[model samples]
Structures are given as structure tokens and as C-alpha cells.
Target: MDSTRILIGASSAPRDGWLHLDHGATSEVDRRPSTDPSTESVPTGRTQRVEAKGELDRADAASVRVALAEWRRWMAPGGELRFDLPDAGAALAALLDPASSPSACDGAETALRARADGALWTAARIERELESAGFDGSRVRVDGGRLVARAFVATSTSPSNSGMATDPTSSAPDGAARDESNTAPSAASHTAPTVDAPTRVLVWCGGGERERLRDLLATYGRVLTNRSDLELLCVFDGRATTAAAFTEAAGAAFAATLGTAHGLRLGCVALPEDAAGLEALRAAAAIRIAIHDEPLQLACLDLAGHVDPARLARAIGGGITEPANGALDDELVRAASDLHPWFYPVELAGHRVVPGLGSPCTPQYLESRTAHRRQMLVDAVLERVDMRGRRLLDLACNCAYWTSAWARAGASELFGLEGRPEHVAQARLHWSSNDFLPEGAWRFEQGDIANAADWKTIRDHGPFDVTLCAGILYHVRNYEEILRWAVQQTREVLVVDTRVQDGDEVLIDEPGDLRFNAIESTRRKVVPNRARLIAVLEELGLSCEVLDVPFGTALGVDHDDDYAAGRRITIVARKVRSALPSARLGTSSTDLR
Candidate 1:
């Protein structure tokens, strides 16, 4: 493929798909062409990294291992080798400093750094440069494009249990009554998802100011501390004496000071004329950073082999849901119990425990009740998503669980309009933190789940692409009226997950104070009739496909989940096509009715 430009922060790194790379592997190497200051030099010691893209072929693995081993010897103390080998080329040579000429593509015998840590420093220095230019650090590699080699630095955060990480930031507490056997499980580290590429960040900051940067790093660190593969490194540039130098020294100081304090290897590039000057100090720093902890990147890749990507994607989604709010009331009691606040792993940690869901769950009687509710959520989700790209509206989106999945599936927009103050607040917190999307694009409004008095205010701000109505169908007294109201608000697709049941079941919330009177009859319990939902859609002159999804205690079933023989039924319906397909993603919302 034509070389792709990888964006790393503000910088860029050029990349070519070489024969040796696989997903998730990482490497560090010295790319400087010659150690001879008399010959040529442009920058500091450079390194070439040949990390596996994911898993690699046995041949490529052997070749990389052989090359790195040989490189280690050449880079060792008092070990001096010349750039004469024709096969490996000047890729290694160029990493030391910019090379005299691009090494012949056939591979040339280039001088090698004997120390793996030295290679790490060289790789990290190169990463800083690449990032400063705006390249995705993950894309840095060797044998990219016409070049002999490029270098990179990398790490992973796998929990070590057979690659299953033990989280330091444990799961959100269910508020199970605390007993001797249970203490809040330690939180899990913010590990790269099993199926996803490992995350790497180079914090460039000042040396003494590390205390200032600690909080920023801590936020990410707390989440991933339990991960086995994550490596945090600071890269520092030189410092300035006067505050005025901040304008010039800010970037450098940020790199140098913080990097130095955090024990990050320092890097400064010196010109050949000053080969042994401050420039070498800079180069040496960069080289040291590149080679430090080089093996971890490789370890992460090996661990990557154990995870199934598709499974991880789903699991990560589960990780972001927030805990449900307050004490369970009548209406909520009717809902399943297993309703964990979405994004529980991140949100309800350290403080703010969920009642009855954690270590000391109470009135175990209610636990079984909520267990059914949890199934309702999962079943409802499976149904709503069947219609990808169909616009959706999640009314009363508590933590926007469906909205997220819909968004991922390419739903135009699952406008999560919330009326409940508690749900709205919970949703906002998750969104702002990137625990969910930054703005919760799927979320646009919050107010009475049963009312729309402020809808005009919402429009003044903006409109949604699709609408999702979750956690609201049972609360409203005027179900049909609200259904029409919600449809009128949607532009194209609309998916609503609500309470329903077979004829006259009169499903009462387990707490049994509130009521879902005259419930619409569907195929089964706590679900409204498909025809009733379609009636509203047809009256509005739209076609809808009603698909049933698993729910209730089905969520409680672990592993095969075979125990959830049957319980709740979730129906997903959406507009088939718009009379106007040409409408922009924004302008279409008003057409929902």
C-alpha cells in the first residue's frame, strides 16, 4: 500500500506494511547510520522498531529475534561494528543520527546497539520526534515504504492472570452488605482491551514540575495500575532559567523536567560539530528512553494472541455503563435487578457504591427481583440493535447503554432524550470523561421522561439523527400519546424498549407501589404488544420492524446462560424509509412525528 501517514499527537510518522509486522508486537532499534562523527549526522541516536502488528509468522519472528540479538551485541560496551553488512542495510545506521544516504533496501550491515535498553532510548526519542510531528505512535515501524527502517517505542497493560488482568480499580460495588469474606475488590488497571491494540502515551513535561503532572498521569494510571503491560514514561527537553524562557522552553522543559523527575530517559540532539556536546546528552537521553523496557512491548503482543477481538469489543462496551441512581422505587423494582450502572468498572469506584449490587447485597429477596431486570436490559439491547443505521431515540437514557451500542453499529444517532434528572446527570458524567463519547452525541436533552416542555429549548441547541426510548415506556400515564409525541420528534429511525406483557397480566413492579395499568399486550410479560407499537408508527404513516430480544433473568445467566429459559421480551422498531432520504443528518429530527 502507498505509505500511510500515522498521526501521533500533532506529529506524523510515515509507514509501509512490511512483510515482518503483525498486530500488537513492539520493537526498538538504533537506526543511526554511523558512529563516526567525522562522516555525517543530522540528529540524535535513532532507533528502528519492528514491533509485530498483531501476531507474526514464525519466520518473521525468528528474523526479528536474530536481528535484535545481533544488534544487542553490536550496541554493547566497547563493542564497535561497522556498517558493512549488505542484507540489513543502513536502517540501523540511520537510527544513530540521520544517515549519509538511505541504506540500500536489500538490507545493509549497520552498526548495532548491544543494550536492549539503549535501543529503547533510541526508540523513545524517535517516538517523541514522530509525535511532535503528529503520527500515531502505534504505526512507527521498520522496512516502511522505500526506507530501510524506522523506529518506535511501545508498551501494554494486560492483567497477568493467564493474561486475564486483575483490576486494581475493581468493578463498581453492587452495595452487597459488606461481610468478612468480601472487601471491595481492588480496581482493575486501564489495560488495553484484549482484542484492541495496546495504548501508549509519552508524557512530555518539565523535570521539577513532575508533581504538577502527577495528577494528570494518575487519572490514567489509577485505572491501569493492575495491568501487566502498561509502561509510563516521561520524555524531557532542556529547561529554561527564567520564566520568560517558558515561551521557548515550555516544550523542551515539559519534555526534560518531567521526563527527568519521572525517571524518564532524557534526550537532546547535538550536531556533529558538537558531537560530544549537549547534543549528545540529548541524543543519549532519547536513545536510553527508546531501549528502556523494550521487552514489555513484545510481551503484550504475545498476550494479545490469547484474546479474542470480537469478544473484547463487547466486553469493553459493558465496561463503560454507569451505575443506576438512588434507591430502587416501585417502577424500577418492576424492571430487572441486575441493572448495573453502565460503565460500572470506572464510575462507582473508591466512593459511591451501588446498593445491593456489591459485596454486601441485602434482602437477597430483592436481588432475585433485580436479577430479572438485568436480563431485560440485555434482551432489550439485542433487539434494538438489529436495525443498524435505523435512527433511534433513547428516551430516559440512563447511562445511554443502548445509545452507545447503536452509535457503534452506525446508527445515524440514537438521540437519548432524558427526562429523569437522575438519569440525565449520570449520563453526562460518563460522557464528559470519555467513559462514554465526549459529548454523548447520542444524548441531547434531559427533562421529565414523560414530558417535552423544554423540547424547543433542545432544538435551539440542536437535533438528533435517530431517537431511542429506553426506561421510559412504563413511567408515562399516557403511553399512546407519548409514543406519538416521540415519533413526531424523530426524523427517521426510532427504537423504543419498554414494559409489556401478554393480555391482562398486570405486571406489577416487585416493590408493587406504582402501576403499569392497562399494559399493552405483546407476546409476553413486561413487554407491550408489537401491534400496539406498530399502530403508533402506522398512524404516523411509518413502517416498523418489531424484533424480539432476550431479557430479564436472561442477563443473570452466566457462561452459556442456558438457565434463563424465558422471561422478558424486548421489541425494537424503526422507520423503514423516509419520504425524504436526502435530508441532512441534522435537519431530519423534526420529521419523527
Candidate 2:
């Protein structure tokens, strides 16, 4: 039996059968450690394992990736690698607790202090790093107050050193090597269901392999013994599962459609051959599935809507068959079908199998009017507020379009407050889909901004450097009061984007002019003219200026060439800390507000 060669960092020792490479020089270990591409620490094609217990937090992303790549190169056909670090949230809790040991608390404080200093790791970041470093079957968990991750080398010859190795031709029992060829598990497609219907089983197999595929599925049916009632929805890849094939397979048991001409029909696979077909299934599928021989893409669209990270971690830890809770697979198709038409189409992992939650802000078809507004907001902030390392507040963050923009621009910390739970979920979904902010840098909390208690919760998180009150000012009746609170909370800049009342005469306490809502509600409370907004900011000891962008950049009651029909404006207000040499507005030494 070959012994496991281990590359352990730090003085903390492990159990027997492990080799610890603890060089006396700490500087060499700190700079290179496990990720030296040229270092031939171990013999070629020899299986090696690594265990970095509580040390990853000390290393940078580039170093970590290099270490993992080196490990992959050294790993034989079936080698394993694992690492663990203190969870940032758990570390903070430990730091705040009086019962924790002084040393433990010190360690926790150090990790969090590094996080505060802009060095941190998120689950998403970890996953991306591992994948980019050539590791497959990546599993991450926040267990027992620590972040643990395990992965294996993925190559053409040896796809994974973990999980049941799958092969198309063989019925390899428990330990037999199997082929995980085209299948890459991607269940993260978070969109509200637009239609409710029964579950459909989509199968894609070649012409000659239809019978073999049926046999293979029968084996799967036995595995899913209790789930035999699921309706079979078959879509052949190319001419593989042809119409004649369907006629022979089940006769009238399946309805064979040529393509996805009709949007989301019962028991149909919308083949992505044309524009109509692609658009039809873009945001319509309740569930998407592929068989073994075909592309190994399967999305439990039902599970994608509200992903609990803990539960998702458990599901991924367990194989594809095992969900964290037993109830996840119970008639999910029906539940997904009942969802309200998603605000917009959302694509999963950029795959054609399932579309994204396509909403007006991040639309698939149009010119993305939401992107234009976000750019305008970014431009206004970059002009006055120094975004680098600043804390930001995003009020009424519907799907966090502006909040994400701030994080991308280098805001150190971000807090987004949204009234709706669904919108918050969408924001989280977007974060999971993209890498806009580092982990633990931004948080989106569900709360009605109009409520005092919720406002207090937001206040506890602030004294923020910049506050954004865009598209939300006109929704509340107490618009002036909201502006007053915003000025008080913000330390430096307050940006406002909304429709201004027509004419030079300043208007105040005016009712909403039916811009965002078709029917009037408490939400459609007030719309103040541009001058009144500027005056309120000035009264709060902040110098105000109206930032100008191109017309039609934002959506409003009217965005045409005519200014008399009301236009959207972006207002920037900066707290005058000291009198400038030029002495503008509230900052003039002669006046001094």
C-alpha cells in the first residue's frame, strides 16, 4: 500500500500516515506554500493529498489557486485534497462572545480584521477558485463553525477522484468506475415560477441508443421507486429520439411536437434550433433534464427559486440523488408550474437548457433600460463620492441593480434594504449567478424602509459614506421626512433619482403622477419637483447639485423630448465638512449654512 504524502502548513500536526513539510523559514512558506507551479515536491503521477487546517485564511487567492494546480498535477488517477478555514460569520460570533478563549478570540478577530481590510473568501469565490484551479466535484460546507471544502482532479482520462464514476455502456455496481462525461450538475437557477403544471421527464438519446436509454431509465425508475407517477416529457437531441421512435416507444403515451413552437406545452422539450423555440422555453420550463449519454445537464428548476445555502451544501455533499430534505422532490413540477410569470427570463450558467428570470431591469430582448439607469447611478457616484473603500447604503434596492454596481466599483461594505421578500431573493440569486462582490462584503435584508423599526435596523448598520434614494422617493407619502432621514444617515453623499414636477415653480407634497404603478396605493405617495428636493438637502447642511445624463437613460412617467411632460433627474448632495477655497453652496465660510 502506497503511503499518503502530505504537505501540511503551520506547526499544528495531524494523525499518523501523514508527512508534514514544515520548513523552518516562514517567509518561503508564506510566499509560495502549496501553489508553486515549478516546484517538483513529489514524484510525477504519484497520488498525493493535502490538508490545510485553519491556514487558507492566511493565504491569497492566487497562492491558493497555484497550490491547488500543483496538487492536481501531482495527484494520481484518484487523489483527494481538503482544506478548512474558520467561517467569517462564525469567527465574528466567537470574537464577540465572552466565553471563547482569548487565543481563539484573537484568531477570530484577526480573520475578521483581515475581512474588514478587504481580504476575505466567500463560498462562491472558493468554488470559482477550485474550478479554475482544475479541481472537480467541489463541495463546500459551513459545518461546526468552519468552512470545509473537498475536491478531486478532473481530467479527460480521470474525470473525478470522488463520487460514483459513471460510464454509458456499463451497469457498474456500487464501486465500479462510471463515466460522468457531459454531466455537470448545475441546480442554481433562481426564478419565480410563471406557470403551474405536472412534472415532465425529458430524455435526449441518439437513434440507435433509444432502447438502451429506455433500459437505463428503467434502472433509474427503480432507484426512484416511489416516483413512478412522474409524466414523461421527451425531446430528442437532433433526430435521435425521432417522432417515429416516440410512436414505437409509447404510442399515444407521449405527444411528439416538432419543436418548441408553442411556449411551454405539456411534455415538450423546446429544442434550441430557432429564435421562436429558444424564446419559448427561455423562462418557461418548470424542470429541465438530460440523460446519461446525452449532455449531462439537469436543472431541478423547482429547487432553484429559493436556495438555502446550508441545504444546497448538504444536497451537493450528498450525490445528485440525495437532497438535504426528503421533501425536495415531492411533486416539485406542480409547485413550479403554479409560479407567477417570472418578471423576466433568467438563464442558468449561460446554458440554453433553461432561461433566466427575465425582468425589465435585466431583460433578454430589449436594450436593457435597467443597465442604462445603473450606469447613470455609477457615473454620478464616481463623480463626487470616492467609491474606493467607502461604505454604501442602497434604499429600496429592487433586485439590487445599483447595489451590485457599487460593489463592483470597489465599495468595501454594502447594505441593501428592500421591502419585498421576492425581490430580495432575486438579488441574492443575481449575486450567486455572478461575481460582483466578495463574500461577506454585501448583505441584503428584507424590511419595509417606510417602517420605523426597520429603519432603526438599517441605522444600526450605518453611518454610511453614501446613500442612494433612487426610483423610490416618489413611492412614499412622507417624501420630505424620508429625505431628512437619508441626510442624517449618510456621512458624505446622497444621490436621488426620480421624476421632477414640470415648470420652474417648486412643487411639494404632490401626489404620485402614476409613473411606476397603474393603480394608486400607499406606495405611490408623493413626487416633489427638482428644486424642492435640492432645498431639503440644503436645509440638512449638504450642498446639492443636479447631475445631468442623456435623456431616456431612466424610466419615468415620460422620457420623450418634451420636458413639460415631466422628466427623471439624478440629484447629488454632499455633506459640507469644511469650506472649500472656491466656497460653494452650504460650504461657503461667509454663510456656513
TM-score of each model, paired residue for residue = 0.32, 0.37
Against the hidden true structure, what lDDT does model 2 obtain? 0.47
C-alpha lDDT of residue 411 in model 1 = 54
RMSD after CA superposition, every candidate:
24.1, 24.9
Over 244-300, each residue of candidate 1 has an lDDT whose tens digit, in order, gives: 332223223322212211222111221122334423323322221121121111111
TM-score of model 2 (CA atoms): 0.37
- What lDDT does each candidate get? 0.32, 0.47
In candidate 2, residue 192 scores what lDDT? 35
Best by lDDT: 2
Model 2 Cα RMSD, 1 decimal: 24.9
In candidate 2, what are the lDDT values of residues 514-565, reduced to their tens digit? 2122122343355566677677677777787776665442221123211223
